[model samples]
Target chain A: MEQRRSFLKMIGLSVLGTIIGRAIIGREMLWLMLSKLTKVQAAEAPKQYGMVIDLRRCIGCHACSMACKLENNQPTGLVDGELETPNRRINWSIVLGREDGEQEKGKYPLLSKRFLPRTCMHCIDPPCTKVCPVDATYRRPEDGIVVVNYDRCIGCRYCMSACPYGARYFNWKKPDLGRPENPQVPVRPVGVVEKCTFCKHRIERGLEPACVETCLGRARIFGELSDPNSKVSKLIRERGAFRLLEDYDTKPSWYYLPW
Target chain B: MTNIEDVILNQLTKTTKRFYAFIGALLVMVAWGAFAWSIQLTRGLAVTGMNIPVYWGVYISNFVFLIGISHAGIAISAAVRLLRLELYRPLTRMAELLTIISLMLAAMNIVFDLGRPDRVLNMVFFADLSSPLVWDFISVSTYFILSTAYLFLGMREDLSRLADRLPGRRWLYKALSAGWSGSEQQRFGQERVLRWMAIIILPVMVSVHTTVAWIFGLQIAKPIWHESGLGPYFVTGAIVSGISMVTVIAWILRRLLGWGKFFTLEIFRGLGNFLRAVLLIYAYFMIAEQVTIRYGGESASLEVLEFYSTGAYAPYFWSFVILGTVIPFLILCIPRTRSIGGIVLASILVTVFMWVKRVIIIIPALMHPVLPPGIGMSTGIYAPTWVEWSILGGSYALGALLYTIFMKFFPIIDLEIGK
Candidate 1:
């Protein structure tokens, strides 16, 4: 009788221990889930900023690219009147020109040319932010704007490899801005990766991004993408715009209107 | 029978002129590498050939190769112990020592590749769990600690035995032995602990290589790198490279230390056959990976495939297959050519070309981006600068130096196996 009672007591203790462990673990898991859910909810709070580029109106002039460079105080690739290699330069916004013979429109004699103005798409589910080892890059929860914490970056460049659009650039050397520095924008140090931030500073101050503001063709539009009545949202809903690499399902906030 | 203990003790005590020359050469290479690194630190990574698109280059490839080589311990020592393969008993210490040295070198390569080496500690303070790089850091560090402990514990008995005999290094041995007297109770406890460590280390080894693979595989940006089979592929490749390294090291030790009796022809043949089998499995994975990409016919992945098979990188890709896999396989397969010298030669080729394989894995993927480069953008050219090469050479010399120094102080072959 005594032996049986001891065995029963042992089983009771183990069961009680298991229950307590389960309760604690379950509570922690619940807290984690709740915290993640709240972050998602906050991200979806209808203030998500985005951009739309109407390719039909684009003239391939590269005014916006120049504006971005000047605004960001980016290196110009010119050193002692000798142009540095393209890889050595940093351009947050670039106009990619696809020349004739690549995509012939009607026949061999007639060829079509297309100009693609590329920048950081600022995706809702960003691959670059996900791959940062130091949590240096992240999508802001409030406005869904992706940003990089330059101070925290270890400059491993995993984010550079993770970006599908090739939007990110690394500061290989010290910035040699021949022009005066932009006091509004902090110059990135050598060795850290930098990218287009959708002009987070300008947007926060109710000013449009330099690229959008300086676009001579009026091709670029910036507004709240989540708001149904916003210009970018209306352009997407009405004109059937497409995001680049749609098959990847990154859910990029930036869209382009077909020519 | 030859007294193995006396032979090892003699090797430890005696310092030959040739050994000093070898160590001297290694130190010079190390110094050159340090000089190159100093230049890089002052100027920046711009001194290296890594440009806009090809942000990673030889350093990353060397990092992966060294990590793969570090698996020698897991493949030879721990697995041999678990399987009770007594033929490989003499090789366990050498393999473990290689693991420690190569792992340290591999980690240094990461530091070398970093843009901001000063901010490396930020990885710990601001670690992001979602990143595959963090996973790799965690797993590699865990494996390093565990393997170091495992190696130390396995050497405890030998250290205790050497403590009494070697007066000059008595304190060092005594401290390392940790009061081990080889008693019945202590032996039992030690055996149990080592057994548990061996078993536990296997998974950590698998996790280490798997996480390394995920560093590329998890990226949806690079279609060629984003493969489900990458984990298993990298692990199998690591084992093949690791075993090849052990074979090469065993051959060197036999030639230099005159330990031909300990590392006999049978051991070489066994290793050769084992390497052949793993190489075949690795070939299967390679075929499967290529076939899946070709059949799927995705534009980006096919571009990457074409880049390997017929595009700009075709030479490297074909050479890796023919030299690293085919010739080695054939050498290991033919019984007549499976002699000790032939096996060693084949191992050297495999070891060298495995590094080339890692290069093929990294560079080609970056060269072929999903979106083509714009008109004014870089054409994605990469060539490692003198600085990069110097640093790489230095790392290899450093590894050799560490291995040689350790062998001078301790037994390269386990002393208590047959006893």
Candidate 2:
């Protein structure tokens, strides 16, 4: 009788404990949700670096891509006298070419080709920073430039999956640099993710990003987005520029002027 | 000695040539796997077939599948004890054993997938609370510890009983038993503790799988993976796969150990009925998922659906439907074919194809990224390398070795209870 009574008492206590525990956790989660909703307002940085690309002026010379590779000291895509597959190559910026009216099946005479230079958008609200299991990737609070701490990344690649633009690249193998690596950029070890940093090193030193500087047609423009007087702001306002995948609400700092 | 003990404990006292051969083969596979891992660590993830876009492949699928299998043991054991399902009492210990071994393997697969395994501790030291992976880490580890304690506590009486009989390992058993003397007071205390643990562990198990699903589901980047229904869908799939694994393992032990009396056909029949109902629920989830994706008509999701229905993954997707779901469901439904042999074959099919389903879920969605494949880039077709296959095979071999060694030391059939 006593054993049964104790068992019942124990069961009752456990039930009560569970209810109390759940209530506390529930309240904490509610508080967290509320806190996150309010924290978005606090993300307004003073000097928001941004880019404005003019598609009409782009010549598709691939100079920006080359310049980016040289500036970042990325892999050369050469292994044992063989060019590595394009998928295996680490490219931070590339110009994508497609027939503009192909989706509508426009007639050959009316159809026109276009080039879209793609890179990390450096969103004001970055999904990559949120999904990183460690704080290896984060947005710089002062300048609003998203960057990765390569030394701290565990190579889980959750950030890669979170980026909607397919902007992130994983170092599959030890990077083989055929030329003398630039002393300015750190040669990231294999296994961590890498992407365009808006040439943060160059920007910090008061110089344009390599891609912006080396564009053959001067299609790429760079300046402070936070300042209304900045060249990027004036171009965006005058040209009626648009961001990619605006539906995603990432608020990309990068913009493009249509041809 | 009672007839039950004589039959069940016979294998502990004796060794056979076949057993030695089996252990040898398993060790070879494990060694091969270790060698492959060493190569991967040195050469980097280049050894695998993974690249950009399809950044994850076989390793992640194996991790999910193994974790799915780990859920059945504790769930079934807890349900049996808590709900007074006496017919399932015989299967509890083996189910719990499977949970421990498979959970270990699942955790190992995560490490195997890591690019820098040496820096894994950074997940804890520099943890991000908002990340779903951290939630998965915490929940899975909590489940592991709780289940381990639950398994050990339940084995106390059996361990104490075996200590006196097995003179060679008397000290080991005595230490493990922790002076469990079968007193009324002790039994009452133990029962209360176990009951509480069962209640606590059930929620943790659900959270573990849900968090795993959230790792993909929360990513708005992938249209197919980002869905509100993913949490329940993953939980249902986990239960189905876990139950199938338990059925297969239980049948194998029944044959190998010659414990036909303990693992009766009636027990299998009950399990079959239970599995059939769960399988139906799982089938419902699959249909609901497909219907929602198709009807929503989101372009990215449509592309993923197209990839599964009529694209590169069509063969694998249909195979899972026919072999894993439909055929097994048909076999389990028919009264004549729901016998022990039929159940085992159906279970084997379900277990194998469920893994195929996981691969299909992970790889195809990745292959069809929202953005188009840019200039000069290949359309990201993934094929696992020999090293990956070898490691996968080695993980199973290691699991089998653990189970085999455990059977040698302990009573796998729970001799103290339901006698």
Candidate 3:
């Protein structure tokens, strides 16, 4: 038994040594790769556009989500063909109901309900883009918006696994646009990943996203975040906005002004 | 003329009516699975029960499981070479065949999991080297090629001996043997090559499973998969499940083919003891993995751990513990239950439960809500459809069929005439 313990001790030490050794080597390799990549990307400095949502003005009406679906040609019903369950539907702009503190404490309702509208954060170092084995998803250098090349996407769903925000959605089946199709956005084929593109098609046409344009409460704000004069930047400066899951280091373009 | 040759050849040349029936059943399954894949190809991934949050299910689970199973062969074969255990000589070729067949099935499982099988070529045309999936692809393919080469190289002496005796398959044997005349120089070259290949294979096998683990482990997005310990944890699981699988296969072959004299009690006993030690180590890893998540203050990992322990996944979690590890460990540990039959039974339990273990690993981590506690973003849970189940069953049958065909064509057990 004593001999077995010593043997196990030896093996553990060796394994620990190997892990530490590999980590050091791996760090060095990562540094070298980052250096080389930064030099190549430095040629074209891109504009970083972002959004800021002030929760104080939101009414939980889901107007932004509807506008997004109308603009993007997303399917109306659940892909599984379930009824009245909008949660399982292809929603590019999801409006979630949030509550603060303990629930069910005294019948008078201590907790307050808040509506949180979630769109693609369009992260600067997007996890989805980083893990796409086929480079189908990429962050455009012209603007900081992450986009998916539908033609190149093999739909391996590795990006879905890597995404912290759960923003990416797969085209599970052929899309059925309930309303008349919007001419601006191209309908994505089945078997490719689709997400909120910050309405890149509209952005290129010098128009704000449909969600921002159609917000009944005017809670959504969008502009060039890197520019100090932009509305998003002004809001961030005035309200001290924060990104969701910031600890993940995704550097999301979207921010929220908490009440 | 030799006793070894006569006995092995007799089994190789003959087959029962049951063998044909078994092959026929497997072929029908393969055809049905191919039809199911076509349906999936025409329709999208919605055909499967996968939805938001639970996007991966049985396909990915089976992929990881088969990859783990493949490790048994090369790991054992390489260990035998390193330790100079002549007792394992008879089992080496069978193990190598298992590795090759399982790997092929694992790759196919990946194809089944893909939303667009046609665009698979895009993985190569525009590859992202930083992605762990790319690392998985590169390592697994490299392992496959090396194992195939190693298997053939090890079989050269046997192939040469059988080339003249098997007159109908002479050309195939001759081509495979690579014109070996059994000279001393040729023998020396084979030894040197085999030794180097064995050395190379060991690390490659380790890296292959580690890379597969990294596909999940590198993701900080999911709390359950993003542990630094996952790499070693997966490797340990692979070795444990692999040895258990090999034990089952070896026992079945011994009983059915009447190769009991060649296999011997000592060989099964050695394998059983080795399996027991590996089980102990795996149990230690499982405990360490659980303790770190359960006791640690990381809320995200804690939520996942809680989910596994007492929430929706509790049934699979507890069953995996009792049947997969604990019971098997006890059975293999006790001298009374350490017989050949006992070991085979334990192996069967471990093998099935390891697969169940993988399904447990993939689902709960994914099902956990990505949003913070306050936000209610409920999504559907995964339940694999008939298409998935059919394809999974077909994949295992295909692997067994391949093994059976290979056994018929070649002398899987080494003669040990020259060695």
TM-score of chain B of each: 0.98, 0.98, 0.96
Candidate 1 local lDDT, residue A54? 96
Q: What value does the lDDT take at residue B325 in candidate 3?
A: 86
lDDT of 2: 0.88
| Docking verdict class for candidate 3 | acceptable
Between prediction 2 and prediction 3, which has the larger lDDT? 2
DockQ (Cα-based) per candidate? 0.54, 0.58, 0.41
lDDT of 2 by residue, B227-321 (tens): 98888888888988999999999999999987788889998888777778888898898898888888988889989888987788889989999
Interface RMSD of 1: 2.7
Residue B84 of model 1: what lDDT? 94
Q: After superposition, how far is residue B265 of candidate 3 from its true place, in Å?
A: 1.8
For model 3, what is the alpha-carbon lDDT of residue B94?
88
Q: Candidate 2 chain B: worst 10 consecutive residues by lDDT?
A: B1-10
Candidate 1 clash total?
0
TM-score of chain A considered alone, across all candidate predictions? 0.82, 0.83, 0.77
Over 4 Å off in model 3, which ranges?
A1-45, A78-88, A98-112, B372-377, B417-419
For model 3, how does the per-residue alpha-carbon lDDT over A186-256 read when each residue is reduced to its tens digit? 89888888899999999999999999999998999889987889888989989989998999888888999
